[model samples]
Target: MVTKWVLLPVPAQDADSIELDIAERQRKRGEPTSPSAGELSDDELASEMLRRTTFGAFIPWPESALERLAAATTETTRRWSIVMTLCAESPGTLFSTTDISERTELTIGEWRTACRHITPHLRKHYKDAPLWGPGLYEGSTEWPLVTMSGRQLKLRHELHVGITEEQAKRWRAVLNRTTQNVA
Candidate 1:
């Protein structure tokens, strides 16, 4: 498993209801409506969300990695929908590109085009450890956050091993519904 993971800026509220629940609790307590609004950094908020929802409190995933996963779930982009679909479907399991394409009901060409859009972003945002080599110009057919080997794609090992079965089902429900909005 690769130890280096991409980091994203902010935590996404869509991945779980914890933030909303917290906000409600605050309301009951007559506290501010925004939970931890300025108190926690983007990385901290992301870590808190993942700890409370997807992974248990003990998973050692770095804050940035957590933010990355949160961002993946929250994005409305076609490329992100592809990633969310793959992760939601397989989690830690390996699935082929063909499998993901069939699941998305996208032709291989469309799938490839979606993947192409992710490369520049990944290359720009994660230059320190380039997620899928340096660039698409190098003939990389891999995704930004997803781990790829030939045609086999899997969620990052941390996500695969860290996310529980029940949590995965929640993620599947959220991701599957969001994926439908891509078209």
Candidate 2:
């Protein structure tokens, strides 16, 4: 087989033209071509940045949700620790019992105890829906906002979206306040 080579003039694209083409494609796909920060407040800009960091994988929870959870679990040390540890992780992170134990320096038994304590709160928050439902994880019913597969663990979708460094710090502050109150 003989391959024929034909030389043709290539069109040159300037920087601005290339950029316009990209913007046009993005507009067609219904994406914002640029940030309109002038119209957004400081808090709104921060929230928008957080949302972009998720890349559409998950939606971050509102301040009220985090406040509610922190308040709900204040009296439980282990549960509060676990919640803060998990919230410190990136959204959609998958870990394990060993992982949580290592992070919290708490025993597996304590982790189990914490899960038992938190499950009721979670069930109420989720309107009594069975979590880690069929085919996801069959480990235990006591884990709310978390699912286990064999030995691996992950935050349930609703809770996972709320994990962020800032959120984790907020949880830590809550834990500290409770500890101070008790002491």
Q: TM-score for every candidate vs. truth?
A: 0.34, 0.38
State model 2's lDDT: 0.47
Best by TM-score: 2
Candidate 1 lDDT tens digits, 38-130:
454666545444433423222232334333543554232454545454555555443445655666665656656655565565554534332
The local distance difference test score of model 1 is: 0.44
Residue-level lDDT of model 2, residues 93-181, one tens digit each, is: 43455566666666766766665566565555633333343444433232323333431212222122134445455556665776788
The TM-score of candidate 2 is 0.38
TM-score of candidate 1 against the unseen true structure: 0.34
lDDT (Cα, 0-100) at 53 in candidate 1: 42
The regions of model 1 sitting more than 4 angstroms off are 1-76, 124-144, 151-183
